[model samples]
Target chain A: MKITFAYWGNYTIAFISLFQKLGINVIPPEKTNQQSIIEGAKISPEMYCFPLKANIGNYLTAIKKGADTVFMVTSLSGSCRLRYYGIIQDKVLSEAGYKVNFVILNQNFIDIYQKLKKISGASFWQIVKAVYFFFKKLHLIEKLEKKAQYLRPREKIKGQTDQILRETFPQLEKVRNLRELTKLKREIKKKISEIEIDSKKNVPRIGIIGEIFTVTDGAINFGIEEKLGKQDIEVHREMDVTYHLKKIICPWKDWQIQKKINPYLKSTVGGHGRDAIFEMLNYTKNNFDGIIHLLPFGCMPEVVIRPILEKIHQETGIPFLSLSLDEQVAEAGINTRLEAFVDVVKNHYNNKNH
Target chain B: MKCYLGIDVGSVSTNLVLIDKENNVLFSLYIRTEGDPISAIKKGLKLLKEKIPENAEVVGVGTTGSARQLAGVITGADLIKNEITAHARGVAHFIPDVKTIIEIGGQDSKIIILENGVVVDFGLNLLCAAGTGSFLDAQSFRLKIPIQEFGKLALSSKQPTIISSRCTVFAESDMIHKQQIGHKTEDIVAGLCQGLARNFLANIAKGKNIKPPIVFEGGVSENLGMRKAFEEALKEKVIIPKYNTVMGAFGAALLVKEMSPQKSKFFGFGVIDKDIKCTSFQCKGCPNQCEVIEARIDGKVMARWGDRCGKWSNLNMNNI
Candidate 1:
């Protein structure tokens, strides 16, 4: 079996599972780790964002594990550096002397279908089944993540909620249909509802917003949601696979966000610059305690939108903390910032109620 | 007599401060951390053991700074806080109406904005630690002037030269170039101070409503030259608080005092006598291959940390 795979993130299960159903010998990419990062960083541009570096790391590891072909998803002209991610990685991999087949999914529907047809030798009907299953699994993954987010701080035992998520994720890969998902959903919901919780606990709620990759991928942002949840802060974020799918299926949602963001962001600078403002407004309107903006070191959209975020913070008087992540980010620094941010939000929440 | 102890373990220095129940700073000691926070903390405790009255019982303990976690573990701290909160808390204790806090420490600098005695927002040095205390320490070493005198000399120069404030490398290189061209030492020093002040404003203080009366507290605030440069730039006078150098420790004391735990978790002066050691190694159990660090006291593990999986961190301790 010639192994084929893509890099990992919130979309890993969806991407790998879809390929698996097509009879491709797919080895799931390993979790982002130190060895892979050091290898990837050595061969990549010094200033590449953490996501790109992480992808390169995973690709190198995939090749080491005897992967013969790889496919990756990319955006086109998001006014962000993401447009060039696949091209740059392909060049870097070729230079490193890898002979594996490479594929880039730039959202050209017919081209993607044709590529799949060529690679898998599957009929049009088969590819359709695989892709439809992909959307369903993506929705399931996001729903599971959202449930875990809600239950983490409220769980009876410290690691109980995360343990549920840990158990359910792999089981999801084997699920065949909406009926199975519904059965799994009921079983999980029963377990969650049965878990003891202090419904009266008044934990400060915080919204996580900013760059999609960093927000979606826990390893890169150092498991911020987990850390915040552990601190007795209820964490909420709207930038998941389903929300992004909505942006793609109904770009009117983005245009609506862009319209609201125009006073702050004159035009789309790519990769969720407009969505960031719209989300910030959403959190504020909902009377959330605080908002944390996670910006990858030199990300164009994030850097450009920083001042606007600050202005909103000033006018709104909501405690906002901007955390920038890079390869050199130390866990201790993020820990310190989060601890202080919790204090700020709790204080703000208390003041509002009084 | 009873007291609350606040210990701040930082990269360059460790500060221990004692405060009364009334929240008045009673005794404060600032000493070089010297790369080993354990010894520095013990030494601080030893000196403190000698000075404080025999009847002075430590009823509460707080820890803050970069090594706050380690210090909290060693001291049995009832309260642990970050530098920003500690600095703000300490400043608000003295000047209740202060609106902004500008703190520059050994390795980091931050601008904290407060409204009504509570910190509302803050900004830490991003991308670069260009003009922090360590940056000043380096310039002073290269210039062959005492750090204490670096600021004094800068205060003497009327016309400060212009130097790039983009980063520490360029700023120091510019200073050396200016010196070789026969620029006065005072002028170059003054120029460096101005550059740092400018950098802090444009970077850390950017978009932060740096309202006065701004309280500047940290090791760097002791530099009179930097103070003058800030005043000239903001066109508003900056006040250096009474306990400028040890404000973080001072604030920790204030926080613990305010929290007022029934009984102190402090290990007492006897902790200085224990044999403490730390060792780290890579765990090959999984692909993450996390580097796990173990802190020990006489071959019994006090703490095991630095692992992504709970397998290591959640393990039961056995004598080793």
Candidate 2:
């Protein structure tokens, strides 16, 4: 293992494949596990957001497996801890006596593959091709998840939709170009369309808006979307790698969203904090039955937005379930809260329809 | 008479309830779980067996609480539900117009807001038990008073001391400082109740509508001091059901009845005599390393769970 990137669901493999195209041997991160979380927590400051600790866990594990370089995700925006995580993590890693090369890339990799160019010293055309491949593959993964979310709640069999995700995500990792990606997309849509579904099932729609990592990484949030799907709830998440990429490609989009959030939030508090308010209001306007806000415990930006989320809930009257999670939370406890949220959402949905 | 049975296997206590066709609770028991829900459930079922008429049949059985899944498998429950849903239904069963429910259990607490007999919102104490029954239990032991009489003693305070209840440890230390500084024990106890009520309303019930017909249930309802503190803080009356301690089981029974299963799957009182064993393993098939739990009765596996992937949980454990 020469280097490893912060694992982001299917996108983890996409990152690895992108770098592998550049002749960098990066092991796909071992899916975030208890061992990694524990390993990460042992060295991390107690109150650091879960994603940071998890990254530490992944890097330490990768180092143990002979990964000599750490390709870390960071930001230049100083509004959140994300901008400084690379520096802090670099210090911590060096202090731990692990001599490793650090390649810090902003999360909006599409607009800034220049960092990769600088590191790999690759030709501009070569870097552009690798970035395009990574972006295309990421978009396809997002599409698969969207289709699965829709079908999951209505599938006649509980696990059929899941079976598709479980089997197809790996097949997606093998996709090399736009042609193969298109073919896989069509086949996935065909498979999903073929899944036996009762379209008339009374499913409540929920919008999930939160910190990117906790929302995107299923392991950290305990696959909350799947849990909701099992209970006949349609989950629509607006925060993902693609969403971030689009926002980065178009800078003015933030200004538009910031305008909507101005009354609720004085300014962009950084990260998804502002995006969450925008998403909640969006969900309310769309008549979503509820919204679930996921944030790592004590995450400053997300935590600050919590009260604003509550205010929005009060004004909009759409039910809201806010879950601040870390390793301290048990899956059983999360399941119970989700069950309760669904029950409430279902009741609210039914009453409105009648 | 045919009756529905509800078994609630919680962290601190196990409750069992028997309700007739008309929703009349015929038998109810609240016993200490004592860290062994299996044995506590068996004890409740044995006691129920002894009390019921010989010709009476258990038409349905339901389970709820933290250990609901475990209890459901052991008792062959027709419906297994979360405690929040069960408690809401239980309260609405008595007070159909119930707008709010404040339930404080042994290890956790919850605030449920209901509108028109349907739950609209709810919250559970996420991190740990801060303001709950366990804290009060520990306090009563330190005071050398029976837990049963703690609430009554608290009600006797003339000038309740001011205390903090944000964290249990902090609250305990605050209570001792008050006690050493010439505060009466009764006053300190009353302050603890008030602090708990304020914490509950502020944290778990934060920003929710506090409407009337609010019902308080669970083991903590027996603590009269808690009710007073709630009533004082809300400036509205708080109602407790007749079988408050067993409300979780009562609601579960009512829900199973509503499901109207064609046949009951209850193991009956015979489960009391069965030897049930629970075992767990860390699965290495995938990177997740799910800790799968299996329950067996007399060497025959009945059910398995706790796996994120369905591989282990979906396996026919009976065959294994």
Candidate 3:
């Protein structure tokens, strides 16, 4: 059965490989862009959060390219909001007239054993091997992505990180042994460390804080981090696999961190939006030149976060910017804003130097 | 001789609570935000300065809320907390036996489930504004009644109508339909409160077990109408703390009192009254229209923020 599966971002590469090992055709959503977001948003409910629209866009884009199935994973316990996204997305896609099949993989429905049986249709031994192989590659990719973060900051050449990522991700699919995966990780780490970082000039140190999906995933956020990289600006974003892992284990840490930092401005659970506001304030007090806050459009946490951020910027005498992305985000507009910010930073740098 | 100050600066209100060396609130003030948090905070500080004795030395200051960071910077807070921890702390402190906390503030509502003083599971309603104080404010405006009087009006109802509260627009239209049907104003007001309560339960409380001693707090805690509605919906009695309105601030203040300060980096009281000017520009950083805002005090840049990239976050400090 030419069962083709599609997923959203770089993390899914390992997921794709496991299915591929089981003789399944796996495809990553084509590099996401502004048009895709708009196209997806046009079909999605206007009130749905931004990541929902972007994911819908990814699936729609895949289905349009002849991919039959899309996968959505969920958590059964913490944060019901995230759990509902998969079901909602399925209904939303069906409403949009895309009759493609959705393979929902949530902790609520399928256990680890059942998932292995359903997806691979293999005996216990075969399933164990496949699972083991998948984790080996998964661990490698996770390490690579982390190392990539450190390396990404070093690369002076524009799109060097992008080019390297594109080449390295696909090579993971060919890994049949643990040694190959281990070798791949070590080489990638070494190469990444060698990438030169231009740290002589002082750059603004901005911190990003927001919802997990929209913040880390580039397609939903419209290539925000990459764009910042081009401006030769050091970006200090905390959203990644590590943060998501933390959310799963120590769910209240997000709030605890908020509690730790926010008392200076507001004393209440302001939500993630409030956390972002505090982070921005921290950045400002620490002498960060600017802070960027991003969320999916109509996102509830950000709604609370936005006004406070506006208030924080107003009160503390700090430079802050906000972007809300749904499927309809325009890349050109985003790029324009980035260029203006870079120009402003450059102007400040020039002024300071003279 | 040493005292502490805790401030909770929210979108709709700014709260200040002065804790004595013993963690007791000596003087507390709650001010309506009125679309200007800085002004509200400044006014809060001014009120704090006047109310407290100068000899009661402020040993530590804590800040929390949506505006905690800005508040921390302004107040020189020694400790800061998110509203959840602060609110949870407030509930745990006042009502030691409390199991669940239902907090409906100006812009959002949350249900914190606690088991023996530790938070087990919690739910926050982020998508809908059906249960928030702002929603009640809008409903009050539509009904041509003061927001403070909404609970009183609901209490007077004999036969309450059931208004659809799935969406605010739908709820408004349903309310108008009920009015046309000649339902008593008090009944309709009661229905509005019930609708908000139902909406909140349906959205955030699906399948979650909510037990007592339930503490209802935040700005909306003052609404007897909503409180009654919650009781009817949950079929259990809800408790409201004495200083319910500023619980998050109080909780945050309590947190600061509990924790030893690393150091007081507070900018001092003089900074609160400064003529700070804030300006924003659309960041042309990539295709993201990040509105980078800059804060200036006395014609010098005091801080810069509002960009996704740290492109300009912490680079300049010529005493700015």
| Highest DockQ against the true fold, candidate | 2
The best candidate in terms of TM-score: 2
lDDT tens readout by residue for model 3, A28-76: 5754555567777788778776676667777776777687776676654
- Model 2 regions lying over 4 Å from their true place: A107-112, A175-190
State the displacement of the C-alpha of residue A106, model 1, in Å, after optimal TM-score superposition. 1.6
lDDT by residue for model 3 over B62-122, one digit each (tens)?
Answer: 8877777566655567876667767877789888878889999998787876655655445
Model 2: which docking level applies?
high
Q: Which pairs clash in the backbone of model 1?
A: A78-A270
Point out where model 3 deviates above 4 Å: A1-142, A146-354, B281-293, B304-311, B314-320
Reference contacts preserved by each model: 0.69, 0.83, 0.00
How does each model score on lDDT?
0.84, 0.86, 0.70
Separate clash counts for every candidate:
1, 0, 73
Per-residue lDDT tens digits for candidate 2, residues A112-221, read 56777766778888887887888778777787788888988999988889888888888887777778878998898888878999988768899999898899888889
Using all chains and alpha carbons, the TM-scores for the candidates as numbered come to 0.96, 0.97, 0.58
Per residue, candidate 1 scores C-alpha lDDT tens digits across A1-354 of 465554555678788878877877787787777778778888888877777787888888888888877787788746678888888888888888887777887755666778778878988788888888888888878877887777778876776776677677777767766688788878878877777787787778999999988888877787898888877889999888778767777878877887777777767778888888889988999999999999887788888888888899988998899998877888788888888888899899999999
Sort order, DockQ high to low: 2, 1, 3
Best by lDDT: 2
Q: Which candidate do you rate higher for DockQ, 1 or 2? A: 2
